[model samples]
Target chain A: MEEIKDTFLHPVVPLDFQNNYRVGAYLQRYLDGFKEKKILGAKCSQCGRVVVPPRKYCGACNLVMEEFTELPQEGTLENFTVGHVNLEKGQWKRADAPYVIGMVRLDGAANAMLARLNVSPADARAGMKVKAVWKDQVEGEHADLDCFEPA
Target chain B: MRNVGIIGIGYTPVFVSKRKDVSIVEMISEAVDAGLKNTGLAPEDIDAYVFGNMATFEGVNMPHLWATEHMHARGKPIMRFATGGTIGMAAFHGAYYHVASGMADIAMAVTYEKHSEGDAQVGLMGIITPELMAMLSAGIDVTGQSGMGAIGGGSAGGISFQASSYLHRSGAGIEHIDAIAAMERRNAAKNPYAHLKDPEATAEKIAQTPMVSWPIRFGHICPTTDGATVCILASEEKAAKIADKVAWVLGVANCASDATTANLIDSQITDPAEQLPAIMASKKACERAGIEDPKKEIDYVEIYNGFAHQTLMYLEKVGMCEVGEAHKLLEAGELEMNGRCPVNASGGVVSTNSIGTSALNRVTECALQIMGQAGEHQVEKEVHKAMAHGWGGLMQYCTITILGDKPKKL
Candidate 1:
């Protein structure tokens, strides 16, 4: 049998939506700390592991992390990636420049935070010391901690 | 628990990037029909239906509500699951439990994904988009900036970090990743149902493909295919009367780690490459299946490798080999279809991923191998037992199932 094509109708759909979300208390506190140039971490009373972008419950210890602690700005780069492309709302395009993104483990924290690294692809390496570069005028948002740079 | 076995399996006519000739419902009905045809069972024989897919990808939430009539599930209890990539196996396990617990005599697990219908990565962005928008509204300058959000690199960028970490810990190079990708592409060429087929694929050729991230090349990634997979599972009594051959369910297990595993920009409490959940889940499954030594007893493996490097990484994490031995196995051509323990004889998820069907394909492919029905892609060795793995939920959740030629001794 010969293959058939162009038998079905093609319809283009364009959907636009607006959504509202609650950042919750834990994240609210974390964002609030960003306004003061302070990085807030939730400390699990039982495990003593500090979690950044703090949440209410400790995933490991299964206990409430009511004690909020301030973390040092510097940490070690645990792992990272260098991407040559940008994904914008699911669309892919060539990046103007290759970018380095890393996961940084702050001092006294058991978990690491993910952030963009202001380092060249050739220079970024695991175990390198890095520090958070916060926005000068923070508006209590996620991007308040702009990115990380070599300490 | 009572014994349960896979009585039949069905796949869409083809697995490709588009199915423009048919509507979504029409495409899925084909797989349902195929299952009925293969098993020689009427729709009434199916006691229940377990459906799964990443609903957000197609802009269709709660698809089962609309798919009920098409699946011949009217008036039947239909359970739905959505756990990222693992939804396939998750749904299949749900069916297995339904039968093994004596609630249903027979059940059908159906999974599919129509990537051509909507933006695949866009659906994945739901996890971090709200926060990104909040950051944008607050005047945080992420525009044209690096690490804008988790969606910046989609899944590949973060996966590169995991790949690099795996290389660091395993002492394996990018060349090893290239070789494994070439191997799977070659394997896919033999799979009649696979989406990506490159029989002449080689490590050098794979290296020539453009890199998406530092260590991830376009050739190393999975294709966003449109397809569906269905497997009919039955209780021991029903299975005996339905088919001459069956793949018995020896054990099934799932493990979930903290969300921090996939945190690339946040503090990661656990390394993605460490894959503690895969280790825990596979070990628990092996224990339940009475498998003391996987390297010796398991005849082959079907790992949920959305990226080629995961095959080597998961082989180690699942304890099929020591922490650093999977690359050695690859170097020795031990992961080939003709090798001592064939891995991903179906070409694996790296070759064809419909997202929803990805994990379930692992189960169905292993069942096909055990039943000697895989045809061109079947391994040469005598198969007694095989393992199927699924990974989902920001790389922290994993499901493992052991399928064997014989039922577990109860």
Candidate 2:
């Protein structure tokens, strides 16, 4: 058979994929509370696992979490990676070539947070401490806090 | 173990990077032809088909539709398999079982990815629960995701943190990762089919390359690729007739995690959890084929090392190491093509990363070594036994296969 095109033609159709992410109405109520400086978490009925960024169910116990309460906005950093690169078009593009990406442990909860911190690549080591920044309640949305940086 | 030999194998010239030269259909055709020619057989001779495609790579609602028509065995049974990076091998696992279970006399497995055509990032965008995204910021990007892991993993004054404890606990160092890149670079140089197989590959170059993730430099992580790979399976009875030498499929397995990226840490204490499926299918195959000592019995490997560090991880997860020693073995040069048990003599995915078809390519490479058809990349000593592995879906899904010379009488 005749060969049509070589394998080195297109590496990737480069594009920027970004969008405004949304949250549930019930969850928005917690975000509204966070704007008022209240940390909200979900309490599991079947298992005693408390969930921050409050969820509706306890993943481990396979039970619903209806009891919602304010929680401590504090948690430790878990396993993380400093990404010096950008995740776009399925390829890594270096911004400054080194940045921190990690999972934050929200206080009084089993599951940790997944996000990037505003710390320099050199200072974003694991087990470091971080605090949540909240947006003003009436004029804010969930992202009003931006992202957690070195606190 | 009942001997399960590869009767056919095929693949497109390794596409170096994303290319628009061929559509997914044409890519599959090239691979299917290579497979048919290698077996000295025709596509019509196959009885069934299995295909693997990571839809993320193609941006297609359903990828692998190309296989429905392009990869022969028309109208016969066909199964499509997927698991992020390991999709290719997952399909191979299905094909192996089709023949092993007596479902078909001869079976074919095909896999490919048109990296040039899709938006992998868009697919990854779905990682956070839709609810979580609404709760987070508007400008949040993928980099932010890894940053979250770091923040949760530990603390530092400024350095981007890694899974500090787990990484340190693994006893693996930068040298091990560097060595892996260097080896693949050298290996890719030997492979004309590889994308970045520049002749002057070196450890320094890989280390000096831009860092994508801390310790994960450009060379250390595989490039997104477009290409295709295929394998043909047959009863030992049919294979012996044409394959002057055969690479038997000893066993195959695939396992998946919940539909969330939440398992990236805590649950991944062992990660690659490749052993769960590998051990299950291996035991079943060994029981049917009667394999006693896999390490002592198997001779080589063509593991799917999409990221160079994974090579060490799999050797250990496959039950070949005591936890962290795979890195030691890796640093000691024990996993090289000339080492005690050569892995990925063809330089593997590290040298040439083929998105969808990498696993099948791994299986085919093993088959080639057994048949002594592997060219400059061939192993030094005769290889009677080999193993192949693959993973994807952000390292959540896994697939593994064992290849041997003959079906052991159970």
Candidate 3:
């Protein structure tokens, strides 16, 4: 048997890939609605299913969602998790404090959206009613619709 | 479709966290060489090759091109596949098609992953990076509460939600997850090629590990392993001529649902715990294999359980047991190596996970059991029929392969 020696080599390969993505018409409308404090969802004509942060196609029905509907701010917390650590570039770092990441099912929306829950980890539970929070200043951005809190 | 059987299987010398002794191609060659030696076949005996790996994890693109000489794929038909964690089984399915379609009499599926070469988290984050960047460009503070909370916790964070949902719906607790982790770890101790071997593992010991997220502990997660696995498939005629023991591929099926189950850019339209694709694929595979009741007909199962809970979760989803009954079976000791329906006797992906080889290893493990080749980890029951499952691709894709002791009768 040939003895093998361990060798290590670290090479610096600096490569940055920049990509440009179009927000598309569906998401653009959803974002634009944020400025007015309205939660927009697209309704699939075939299935009548409404999805938040609307997209063009409803995969189950295979139909284009052309109709836009305003979703109610209050909904049920479908599911949640309390994160004790943050993953930065795939590395784990203990968070300063525990926080709640909840999946909120907005009223009239068939799908559940991922959002930060304002409630403490101890107080968070699935199926609890919650409402959306908005930033002080209106902006047509993802940040405009702030975290959700127990209603 | 013609009958195809797994004639031989080969694994790298070891599956560990690091393989500093060998380069990526060199590591891959070890498995290829082992496969050739196992079947007493030379390089020229392989008619085609199907290679798979998560290139992002290794920072290598089109690795098959570089591994051509090592894999004996030079001047041979070679196809590449990458479907997240299921790449291994996907490549195996590709090789099966090669032989089943009569294009090649002998085909080899080669899958490997060297996680030490690149960042696993970074590779996983790459799936949703474009979406995050899109939001960041639109003035969304991705580092803030809204962005980080939704998409920041890496794979573990996202999976925690699924775990919690599974617990809630299945009436199982975190203790069941602990139990499954301990069970698989103990199973790994019997497998020479497995990475995380804990002969004295117990549910209480696993429960002591710190929680990464609610319902998910450090002990429940799979380690990033460096290893390669190669499986050779041949037509029935060729298999009879070359190998005395062959694991016949009775049925193979895969299904993909919408990618929204991962809750990446948008919200989740489907419940992550409600793995419809697994149900569909398993049903289709079992039906094609002429299996009426998997619980009674199937003798063994190899589930691609990256998380311990998945072993139980997929059992229900694949119709091995009633929904929410897996944990109950666990309590009855029915899922153990000596139990009625032994699952993951080779420790499963939860014990040894090299993402690219994880799924393929499931098939190979089942084949080994079917052929009565799994020495130390072989289940007590005689395995006449076995099922192998692979899950990946943003939680939407599922591949199922059913292997039998004898080839299906025409």
Candidate 4:
């Protein structure tokens, strides 16, 4: 066997890809409500449950959720986490500051929505009252519903 | 449907972080050769092939198309599945269905993962990429306050919430999590194929590890391993003719729930710790298998526990024990290799996680125990029946398979 050198001959190939995803009719309408500073939930006629970030189907009832309803701004924090690190793509790095992320059950909606909380990590508790804060300048996109703050 | 049995199982020579000497196809061929060697069967005997792996983990798409010759699957009907960590079991069940449905006399389920070849985290994030893109299009930065932007908590962060909830509801402490991790690591030490072996692992040692999240330590996580696992399934007649000892498949079932809580992004009104899908899938499988009481019938178990806490959590969810009783069982030494009901005698996914093989390993491990061919790691008890579990697909999907020493009574 011969000793092989020039191990540096390994080549680097960078593959870049961009894709366009259809927001679909359900989410498209939900985002449209953001323009009017309103949050929407789809109601399932069979189960009578309201799902936020509106979708076309209710998994529990297996019914078409075509009935759109407006949800209240206030909610109860169902669950949360205090992140000490940040996950980027596939790498983990220490965060400059720990932040609180909460799962909130908005009023009048049967399902919960996830959003960052504007509170200290120590103060973040499950079942705490919170209200949504918007970006002021609505762009008809997801960011329009900014982080939730303690109510 | 016809009766199906596992006739043979094969694993790579080693489960490690890397296989630098061989290419992806070359590494998988090792297991194929081992399977053929074990059952004295040839490539021609296998009528079909069912392959699975976490796609994009190795930077390759539809790898079976490129490695047909290496897998000895040339001119054979091939099917593939990709269900996150449960792909292995999913593919195994695919082969089981093929043989059970009388489509083929014999079929092979091959599953593997070479995490060393690509970035695992990136591959994991790919599951929520579309969600991330939607978040990005909304002008929300990818690494903003919601962690990895919207729905970027990754596996560990979300699992922490699960672990915390389990601790709260079960009245188990973080110490129990440490104990479970330590126990599985110690179990891994006895298995040759396991990747992370720690015979002397203790709760104190596990607790010493850095805390990644509340109630979860670094030691509680599964390692990314490079390895392959293959199992050969056959019809009852074929199994009896080809192999002397067979692990009969009494039942097989899989169920999936909402991917919200599993993704750690926007959780619906569901609780991650509830794990309703696991309860439903296991119950449905037990019913199909005619098991009147799983707690009394199952002699051994192999749970797809990527994290140590899941071993305890799933044990209860699968009806192996009453709710909030798995930890108590653990503290009583009932989950050890020589316990009343031994669990993860082959360590578990917590010990050797080749993401694709993790789920399938549970079934194969249980089969080995039922066949009495597990060698040193075999449970001391006379194993009559065992249950193998696989949990994946954003943690909402579950696959349950029941294996028994005797064939199912038709």
Candidate 5:
């Protein structure tokens, strides 16, 4: 059907784009850590809040997360969900959508992270174990192994 | 919160074609002009403005000023807000605050998405990067939304997370999901102003359409609409001078959670869309309006159902029912226009929407119904009170507004 539609009308201008979603204003520290196959977290001295994936400040205390530390990419999976719907035009289908996306709590990390799971949503549970599959540094930033899979 | 009411509302029909009749600037003017006209007010009547189109799409660093200037409302207090799909209602809340706070006698909120200038899907996917394009695309055919301007991003980022939770927790099947898509498509057919108003829509047709992503068919997604919507909010004194009927903003609230942001490498970032912000807002608005149990007290609702999943989420978010019971509400037919509480009587954003403009359309439909002006979709019961919920930026930016027939002393 797309082929049929493309025959009569075609796009002339190049619609190519880029991945401009960066970590933060000074994203280098975060990007540099991920590039070295390590997870980073930020700690607030005033409130003693630990933030995973790190942050410039502790949201609660409204103060800077002064401590910078590398935490293990290991945490218990909290209340998990397997989303079956893959949206194109905001419609749902029986097939074609991506696998389940789950929330995970990293070891010693304050806030949980949301990403993809390699395991089937059906088999997924709240306490299931999972791990990140970081992309090869040579592949550059964001190309980091699409998402986390079963450990 | 002070009492605020929507005096007038106007939304342009979402068109598929690149309207050559008017420039983008003029297109926005048409909507703002109509909204002002509805209130019998001029440009100067508005003391402030809020524009809610994601900046990524406009390529305009400042959308608020552009819309304000186009509406001839420059030099007034203005704010520009963007949240993936929720910006429209988010901006609506911005203008609502001014009137509710006595800061302004009248205010206007304008939102538009002109995808004709570029590809919507590719533009939407600009959040990540080239090699990771396949991530957002996943296994779906995101063609229509490919170049559509990216608003507050939602299911676009996390595919299986929300849907899986909804189905798993509710014990719903693909048939139920298909039912949702069919219902909205059928509803859209009734809406002549809708983008894809095909009355012939059937579950088999939706099933046959190429599955863009799992559980989400082409019919389930919102149209890549190009249009604008403007809503004029006025204080009690000014509202009294407007049209015959005034839909008071009984309840209005906005809230957010801390753990919304996520690492691309991380899986399932808590799906913050589930936050009770919209419900909280509804409670606040209900308090001011003095109406309890919106299900029993309200007569009509226009929820943000950009995706069928959101309708489910919003049902719970607006406190219409218990969380995860949205699918059940659809199954029970509780959301039908004739049911206990009618929802999406205008066919909803799932049927006709320009994300930024869609939410205000919800507010407008309520005012029209209160004014007894809804041409075909008016409810049998006199619309004494109505509610409108708008979910912006991944459902992260939630705004709930309640409108009523009479102004109550708070």
Candidate 6:
């Protein structure tokens, strides 16, 4: 039997999709808090646990979180990763430099928030005190809170 | 419920980075034919079919519709399932249900992934694209430092957090991850179908690989491959009549947690390493299988480890060992093919990952071990019972299947 060489074909079918989503009432209130530089967290009625970016339901207690509380900007870094690459549209590319992405447990909030740690990778450590850095001019947006820095 | 047994198992000739000679449906047909041939049962013997794949990876929606004839399910009842990386096991569960429900005496589960046909990372990114787009529209700079931090490194990024948390909680070091990666790669060298085989692999060699994140190295990642798997299942009566050796499906269970547990931007209330769902699913499945102590009765384990640390992480989560004992077990050489509780003798998903076939391969590998059909990768010990685990969906979903050498007595 004669061996057959593999052939290839490349066809481009561009599929560009745009979808709309409703942020819901709880997240709406949470995002709105950014305008005032207030970090709002929803307090679960059953467990009394607070989560930042206030969600409506608590997964652990299986209860609604109707009460909102303002969390202090300062928190303790609970865990972090020093990333050396960036995923651009799902492709891996070398980052300009290594950066720390920290999991910070803000004061008064039971859950930890993920954000860029504005410190050298070597300086980032668990249990280190940090504070939220707000944009120079605040707009009601997710990025308005910027990154977290050493307090 | 009727007892179901896996009577036949089939795989594509090779699982590699690319299959340039075959098209998507063509590759799937090979596995289907292999299953039929292995069972000595024609398409007529199969009363139903369950098909699955991550459709987005191939940019082909409703692929089952296209693969109907190729899979020999033109007129039979067929159902499709897709659940991130667990689609393979999810489809297997669907086929098991068909037989257990008394709906069909024999059923076939087919799963495949031709990642070479399309972009896998893009498909993985699609899972969170809606949320990412919503954030972008809400004035979030996805390209900015904070935004990149938020996205992390896509799947690898989110996984790094889970890996780091697992390291912290388990008190294991990066070297353990390197060792497990090397061990599995060396195991892969024995399996002809495995994609990444390295007989000379060592922890030192793996550690030399560049770091993608703090704990996740490039060597720790699973390669996207092109392959298909087919499993034929039958009722107890049919299994006894057709196959001399059968791996009985003793129990199947799955558990799902809140997706927000690993939702990076929303803040995680539960630690990613705290896989309560895996524990719950394993406990339930083991109880149903009459396995009171998995550490003793379970002879083999095939864990869905897309990364090396996950093998240790899930081993602890699934109650195979104590909280921080998996790495200790690794150091004791208890996880090798010749060890007391051998794991991933077929090299595991970390060695060869065709996403859709990855989880199903776990189950099939276990079945092969149970049937004493696993050739080069077979463990030295006699296998009586084995556990197969599948995990996917933002790290929240877990599916477990317990298999035994003989059918459970009613």
Using DockQ as the yardstick, the better of models 4 and 5 is 5
Task: Tell me the tens digit of each residue's lDDT in model 2 across B35-150.
Answer: 88777776567888888886655555444553454565446677787666677777887887788788887888888877666554554433234312322332334234443443
lDDT of 5: 0.66
Model 2 lDDT, residue A10, Cα:
18
Which run of 10 residues does model 2 chain A get worst, by summed lDDT? A6-15
Each prediction's number of clashing residue pairs: 10, 61, 0, 0, 51, 1
Off by over 4 Å in 3: A1-151, B129-143, B262-268
List, residue by residue over B1-410, the lDDT tens digit for candidate 3.
89999999999999999886666766887899899889988787999999999888867888999778668676789999999888999999999999999999999999999888777776776665544554455455666665555455556766776788899899999999999999999999999999999999999999999988778899999999999999999999999999999999999999987554333323434466888889999999999999999999999999999889999999998889999899999999999999998999899998998999999999999999998989999999999999999998676689999999999996
Candidate 2: misplaced stretches above 4 Å? Answer: A1-151, B1-3, B62-67, B126-166, B257-293
Pick out the ten consecutive residues of candidate 6 chain B with the lowest summed lDDT.
B260-269
Per-residue lDDT of candidate 4, residues B207-282 (tens digit): 9999877777889999999999999999999999999999999998998775544332233445668888789989
Q: What is the TM-score of chain B in candidate 6?
A: 0.95
TM-score on alpha carbons, each prediction:
0.71, 0.64, 0.71, 0.71, 0.65, 0.71
Which portions of model 4 show Cα errors greater than 4 Å? A1-151, B130-143, B149-153, B262-268
Of 1 and 6, the candidate ahead on lDDT is 6
- DockQ metric for all predictions: 0.01, 0.01, 0.01, 0.01, 0.02, 0.01
Residues A1-151 of candidate 1: C-alpha lDDT, one tens digit per residue? 9888875322112234432223456677888998899999989899888989776556454345789999999999999999999999999999999999888999888888989999999999999999999888899999889999999
lDDT of 6 by residue, A1-151 (tens): 9899895322122344432223456677878999998999989888888999786556565344679999999999999999999999999999999999989999988889999999999888899999999998888889898999999
* Candidate 2: residue B31 lDDT (0-100): 83
Model 2 earns a TM-score of 0.64
Per-residue CA lDDT of model 1 for B221-315, tens digit only, reads: 99899999899999999888989999999989998765533422333344658888899999999999999999999998999999899999999
Q: Write the per-residue lDDT of candidate 5 for residues B1-410, one digit (tens) a residue.
A: 56667777776654553554455665776687677776678676678887878666545557666445567665677777776666777787888878878888888888887756545555544433321333233432223344322212324434434555566665666666666667767666666556766667666676776555556666667776778888888788777767567777766666554323221222344443445566677788777678878767888878887766667666776777776677777888776656676677677887776666777778877777787777676766778888888765533456777778887677
Give the DockQ (C-alpha) for candidate 3: 0.01
Best by DockQ: 5
